[model samples]
Target chain A: MKDEAMALRDTHVTLAHGGGGQAMRDLIDEVFAAVFQPPGMEDQARLAPGALAEAGARLALTTDAFVVTPLEFPGGDIGKLAVCGTVNDLAVGGARPLWLSAAFIIEEGTEVALLRRLVATMAEEARAAGVRIVTGDTKVVGRGAADGVFITTTGVGVIPAGREVSTGQVRPGDVVIVNGVLGDHGACILAARGDLMLSTDLVSDCAALGHLMEAVLAAAPGVRAARDATRGGIAAVLNEIAGVAGVGIEIDEAAVPLRDEVRGVCEILGLDPLYLANEGRLVLFVPEDEAGAALAAMRTLPEGAGAVVIGRAVAAHPGQVRMRTLFGGSRIVDMLVGEQLPRIC
Target chain B: MKDEAMALRDTHVTLAHGGGGQAMRDLIDEVFAAVFQPPGMEDQARLAPGALAEAGARLALTTDAFVVTPLEFPGGDIGKLAVCGTVNDLAVGGARPLWLSAAFIIEEGTEVALLRRLVATMAEEARAAGVRIVTGDTKVVGRGAADGVFITTTGVGVIPAGREVSTGQVRPGDVVIVNGVLGDHGACILAARGDLMLSTDLVSDCAALGHLMEAVLAAAPGVRAARDATRGGIAAVLNEIAGVAGVGIEIDEAAVPLRDEVRGVCEILGLDPLYLANEGRLVLFVPEDEAGAALAAMRTLPEGAGAVVIGRAVAAHPGQVRMRTLFGGSRIVDMLVGEQLPRIC
Candidate 1:
């Protein structure tokens, strides 16, 4: 308790905070140390004089910038999004997440109160993800540099040597699966914009997926690929796999899960749920024989309760993705030309 | 090569390009593989289906968002700046940067030509730094979702063992050194804003510090700490060390090196040169006994030619930073209230 108060009092982040000095120490010891441990990682202890300790884990690095308009959004804000976004990236890549470094771009007129809330939320999110927020950089743009706040988070994780998977490994006949419903992230952003007049008590599907992924990878050793369905939706994902593997994919649209409320909103907005964004959910591909096992494992995790086999890889129409509609028509599932939800992540 | 071209043609990046599929793979191979080389870092190699690689290297990760309006400035553009920004971070942290992941936010109406140029520049910069641009993502926002282009880059580096350094190590009488001139980056940004009627032909001193840092650390074995003089500039950095080490810093005004043009611009804008930013420079804290050797070693490097011993650590006023005026009057160097050049990164 004494340490917490001292940290907060002595080290709450300030602009000069990232300058790398006493303020940097207080920030690291008080704020970063209290949560995820990043004191020492490798050769850094030798090279980095002020580093806490050498992080013992093998490194997995991911960087993301948060520019969700409204600064504050339904279910989450830029701060929360920044931390979870990087956390999920590491998770899907099968990395045990570790330290994070953040940089903030603040507009000249940004409200101090809001910035405080954002930072606090960021700290909370980092702790929740079991990672430490270590070093940082901050810059103020003339009222035009950015909106209220744009946060970029870079994270390092440890990936065990044997656990390597890439989109290249996916093969024909692999059953494509989604952990849960999609479009929730994009829909919430649309709702937040309020210009859509779209009202349906919907919130974003943004949540961390580390634990959920751990469950699936543990249960199904045959999981060929994994990716969070954030931008470019499921269709985009299938096309990506097809293009990478020089294969084709066919989806049973009826089997793809969606919330009726979200569907209705998308219908009104002319938004293709296939192209809409999802924050919390992931799309997985596995051998046909292992699909069932993957599904059962996914169900065991709360975030993946809606797990379903939505598609399968095909040899025909190599490098293309297609879907069979409930109406009995088949059409090419194309990559979205533009963003369905801009600044969504 | 045939397979690569076909792969590139089949999977075009779209809103769902980041969706983790063939499209993602295609883009990764077509775009990224064309530029970077990582160990087993090719697009086709698969991560072990259920295996994870716990990072073997002591890791340092940094994320930065580029909102430098006008995008292109003298000496560099946003693309070049983006790559260098993240690289410098890892370099200053005493890490051998290994990989970089890039994410882009494109506002509606942004010219594809500009985006292409920026990307090419990014590739060029990465190559110059001898680092790989491994993973990437792109999103197009609605017209108002963002400005022209905002890039987020994340960098990962391996820090050697036994080189732990931090501001917490500041000791009374420790010598302070700077790699080169300060305020050039920020002033160049202001001059480019063009609205200032800023007539000087000064360009931003933006470049990767990894090489220069490599040289300094190779020779200055006793170097205590190092930091890039970036946002909030020199004062911000000094204050940070003071607060962290629980020591005071005293700077000799005449000893602080600055470009004549940069100084004039700061004076005209009523900006404090100390609060400006530097992209290609680093601040080194070394024990007094080794300060001369460190500065001498720095002078031998092209990037470090402007190295100067700016100040020394003092036991009194443990958390204050004092800068002696040219006339010999010492003034408290407080934290910068706001940025001098907004969004210059």
Candidate 2:
């Protein structure tokens, strides 16, 4: 089997590999099935009851499509981003991710080596996050129909009993905290593209936050809600939370952490770091009394090492976000109206 | 909200619609969120326990990516096909599909009106199939990066206690049954593409088979296994079952049902009807004694009006499929080798 897979790896993927024939079977068996090692050859994965068996435990389901350019980037590739993105979506909702279903839409003539690398990265990330890639499907389209490859990962998790998290749960007195510095991933992608002729060594802040979130939940039980500051970055998340909760959010610009290189990239591009995407960063809304506990717990994990309070919910100016600059000026941070950066994920 | 959604339907999809900001939110809200009406605004859908709570019940998870060209054809569109495809995958495994997550990768510059039509069809189909579109995500790529729109749907179902279905469970004496006439989907797509200058009113045989499968399972409890005759059609399915169970399959060519138009299309294109895809078809392996019951149960549904017995498992020539021709000659029916029809699903 290994020999067969190795032989197939020397060629680019063809449409026959997705035609539901012997070639397709060989591709699936030798490439994906060998690594995933799903338990049965059934159309669906039969998963035994776990946290879902507990009383009052609810199922958490989410899906995301990854279409990042330059499939391979500095710190991570699209595979790592796909896994981390889905895992974090579940984690921030206080759900323990258990299984993921990854579907690939590959453009014909794509190198098999690229697929192997992406699959390997996915398997490694899944192992690290303690989840299983149990079921998947692949479709191949003609050249120019798709960009190299696109992955859509759907995650399944279980929210333990008594664990309720939502933007609506955020209250006026809640304290807003972020796990780490902002915009590393956005800046990294910009430099990686090399379109602007700017060079930087910044890597994507892409990492699974399930473990870090679990730790924070244990330490700060009073945490109202948590959200990953991803595509729209911290600004989008803040605006969404404030709009949903019908409250105002106020942040101190000086309190927000940022790396010098990331800040420089944003300044050069005339973009605000607050709206730049981040893969590993998240915002936590905790009760004022438990804010310290959340910060302390977050600081212990490498993914959350730079945890700090950047803002708080307020009763003034309901359904809006404001930031106070170091020069004592205040400005409203509204939801982005148009495209700032495309396919930043 | 309806006015806002109506106003946005005039323009084409832009990068801003996928930027995770206000424009993205508006597109999601007016186009998708309004129709799907997912339970909450959280990143994940929190689903209350249902059939999963039963003792010995197992969770069923499956994913599929649909990149059908032309987006729409007679009888159904991509949205309708996406829902039925995932639902049928679960149903054939003796699982009750309960929820689905849909993720879309749309190319920039695609018309928003087309999106609305797709979403509307999805909502209608989900209602008819008795499943919920609980959570989803969307990403947009630049023009030409994608064909038009690609949808990946992940389904969650519950396999009730004591139910099991797998290709490996087929026995030598099992009887084979299919729900309906084959090749309509493939023929319809060929006509829709208009590349061969063929014209036909044959519509795609795309429909949700969950209810039909449930009825058959109830009536024929001795059914061994079942598989949907999709991509590579019945030929691929038979090959897979034979290879897995190490049993030979012999089908009666005279007994297999095919529409005249579909057969004409195949003849013109020099294609074998057996190798053409079907969106609403399945082959079931049942104990010889229960074959009548299974056929009776299947015929009770509109989707299975043409139910018939076309094959049986045999001990001779293990791991091979043979067909008894109308001329009384037997021929090896091997798996498809290359692309017969791309993006048929």
Candidate 3:
């Protein structure tokens, strides 16, 4: 906090910081450049040729925009969400996340101290994700023109040789698994809002899963597909896989893992745990023979300590998902039709 | 517009379009994916390994955000600005532009027809730039939470081996040159707003300069520096180069190119043409002996037909910029102190 105060004497963002002059340069130099330490000037980042030539693989590119309300959350902030979101996108595509670019859209009158904290959080998160923020941009709008701040992150990574993970690879007998408990992120955000008149000792499960994903891929080379359960949660991921592969997914409700606090919150709010978002969790499908090894490898990592086999793919009811409830009844799970929680990240 | 109407029954954006479900998929398929024709699904875009391996050089990454007012102008729209902006950043850094990732933050209640036009414009501009729109993300915020729309674009390109362009290469004897007329973009946007009750036939100078930059580099391999005159215009670029190289720059005001329409707007509005924004213009520095060759090469391209030698670097008055007036007077040209035109891109 003291570091932020000394960085910028102004209490709020001003028009000059986005004027593309000395003020803008000072803001970038003091905040972004101080953290990124890019090789050359702040305009464009030039990477070493030798470093890339040795990777020797095609690059995977992905992008996401984060505009979650209440910039700061229980366990993490928008900065962590931006880094982990882009990194996980690359990781799920069978790529090793390497570089990222962050662009900020800030509203005038937003506290400069808040921006400093956010940039610091982003730098820390980038280091944790094993990626460098190569280049970035900042723009400021009038008070009503935008919310406090919105971040758009883009990432690049190298796909290892002969690695192909797609829904097309799924088979009828493929086994489905999840890395950890679901709905922690969404539930935590809801509680943080302080509108539900509820309280719980829940923290967001936001984390960068590149390392854990690498471990799983190493153990289960035959993994058919992998996707993070983000916005529409595990239910949305299953439906997507089913629709693309033209297969049926059957989940055992008893085997799906969830924290008691998350389940309680969902029940009170009339929301289903399956449709809530998760940041640190991923749904993976592999051949039946490789599921055990994949789960064992995932369990070794703290982020995936709750890894479990939740379901299997089938030929019946093609392009559909069905859950066998704990009461021994089956029900269809379809794609969410409308917004549930806006800007929950 | 007719296609947009047929695609979305209601013309305005809805919360469901950003829900990460069927609605989002349909929107992407009908608008973005249909135009981009990305290699794979919207989750991630994978580049062919063989293609990248052949490039055999380091990569350059850059990102920029566009919140320009008046989405549509005489010569270009926000889409063109977003694409050309990032592409120029890479080209100025001596990188062969390749791929781009675009992210959009749309306000709810905005017309889908407007979005379709913007996306189409982006696709066309990307084609002209010889780049691919590989990956993208979209988010929608409630009305009043955001302005109409904002775009953030990130670009990746490979820097050819042995190509070096930086302000550090600048020397006291280097010559300065500009590609074309200045202040056209800023003037055009100002007139487009209609709030000033001003009318003119002027159009924006927005364009992707990858090919033109490549031609200049081929003709003048020993060029010391290059930068697009965007916000803060040529004055900011000169001040930056002076500060970074610890030298002085002296400009001949009579030699600087400017359109009559742009000059008239600046004079009537009490604005300095040197501080107005430009889209397609660039400031390049080279050795005095090679200045003629660079000018000849630039004139070969339509975008640089107005290229001229405008200034020279000096060892005295280090880190300063002074311009010789048409009346034989000289004055310091320091960095822009405060806002001139907001959201000028």
Candidate 4:
């Protein structure tokens, strides 16, 4: 069995590998099943976690599809991003992510070595996030019908009894805090694409935030809500909170953290850093009395070492978000209107 | 809000609709959220079904990616297939599907009307299958980077207490039963492609089997296992059961059910019906004593009106499947070797 498993001679994926025949079985056993180590070959994974049996605990589910260009990039690849993206989606909802299902659509003629690297990275990320890759499926499309590969990951988690986190939970006088530098991921992808003739030392801030979230919840049980600043960055998140909570948000422009490299990229590209995407950063809302505890808890983790107060929710001007400019003027920060960076995730 | 919701003026999808801004929100609200009616706008869906709290109950997870060409087909489109495929995966494992997460990878310039139709069909199918589409994501890639659209659905289900179904549970005396005529889906897809220049009245046998499976389980509590005969058809499923259970499966060629139209298409294309796909067919293994009850239960449902016994497990030639020819000769029915019908699902 070991010899046959190691004897996959195909250099590139083919239509036959997705035909539900011997070739597909060989590819799955040698590549994905080898790395993921699922519990069985059944069509579905059976899970009986203790968390689900707890009284009043709710199940949380989320999904994301990754279609980034230049499949591989500095700091992380599509595989790492897929895992972290879904994990953070659950974590921000106050759920403890437990299992994930990964489905891949691979174009014919994709290199098998590249797939192996992606699978390995996914396994590593799943391990770091303490989640299991329980079930998955693969499909192959004809050349030109699809890019090299697109991955969709679905995550399952358990929200503890009596725990609730939502955008609508934000209230007046709640302090807004963010973890780490913003726009590093967006700046890194722009430089990685190499289309604009730019170079930078910045890498994607794509890290799973489940552990950091758990730490914060433990330290400040009164945290109102949390949202990962992903596709539309912090600007989108703040606007969503304001609309959903029916409150006004005011942010101090200087208090928003930004790395020098990211700032330089935004300036050179004539872009606003506020709308650039980030993978690991999150905006958290807590009551004024617990804001210090939340910030202290976040700063204890390396991923959140730059945690700081970026803004606060106010009763005036409900359903609006405004930024207090460094030059002493304030302007409304509206939701993104159009595409600033495509496929940044 | 009502007028704004109906004012999706864009005829075709563009990068802006996936830019995590107002456009994306409008698209989601008008096209998806309006139909699926997810409970909240949070990153994840919070579910507290009573089934999860039951003692000994287990959660089931499965995922599948659909990339069939000609997005629309005679009997169903990719959207219906996505929902049915994931639901059947959970159903065949003795689980009652409850929720699904759908993620789409769409090419820029695809018609918005096409997307609306697909989402509507998905909503209809989910309603029929008794499952909720709780969360979803959409990404738009540059033109030519992807086909019309690819859907990946992840399903969550629950297994009742003490219910166990596995390929390894098929005993030597188990009887193999099929729910309906085989190969209709594969044959229909071939004719629908338009490249073959063949026309047929046959339609893809695509339907959700959750209710049928529940009925069967209720009728025959001792059934060993069940498998949806999808991509590589009954041939692949039989071979897998034989290998996993360490038992030989013997079938009578004349007893296997088939439609004349499907048989004609297979004959013209020099394809074997045994290796053709069926979206709504399943192979079940039940104890000889309970086969009658199981078949009778299946026959009560329209999806399984043609249920019949096609084969039986035996101790001889363990780990292999064989067919009895009409001329009194027998031959081994090995697993499929290569692609017969690509993207037939």
List ranges where model 1 is wrong by over 4 Å: A1-59, A116-125, A327-329, B1-57
True contacts kept of 1: 0.19
lDDT of each prediction vs. the true structure?
0.71, 0.91, 0.88, 0.92
- Identify the CAPRI category of the predicted complex in candidate 2: medium
Docking class of 1: acceptable
How does model 2 score on DockQ?
0.75
Candidate 4 per-residue lDDT over residues B1-345, each given as its tens digit: 113644578999999888888888888888878888998989789998569679899999999999987799999999999999999999999999999999999899999999999999999999999999999999988899999999999999999999998899998989999999999999999999999999899899999999999989999999899999999999999998898889999998989999999989988989999999999999999999999999999999999899999989999999889999878899888887679988876
> By the TM-score metric, which is better: model 1 or model 3?
3
Superposed Cα deviation of residue B158, candidate 1 (Å)? 1.9
Write the residue-wise lDDT of candidate 4 on A207-263 in tens digits. 999999999999999889999998889999999999899999999999999999988
Error of 2 at A320 (Å): 0.6
Please provide, for model 2 over B253-298, each residue's C-alpha lDDT reduced to its tens digit, 9 standing for 90 to 100: 9999999998899888899999998888999999999999999999
Clashing residue pairs in candidate 3 are none
In model 3, what is the error at residue A316, expressed in angstroms?
1.6
lDDT of 4 at B62: 98
Q: Which 10 consecutive residues of model 1 chain A have the lowest summed lDDT? A: A42-51
TM-score per candidate: 0.83, 0.98, 0.96, 0.98
Please give me the DockQ of candidate 4 compared with the native complex: 0.75
Candidate 4 colliding pairs: none
Write down the TM-score for model 4: 0.98
Per-residue alpha-carbon lDDT of candidate 1 for residues A52-138, written as tens digits (9 for 90 to 100) = 232333446666767777788788888888888878888877776667777776665566557667778888878777777765655
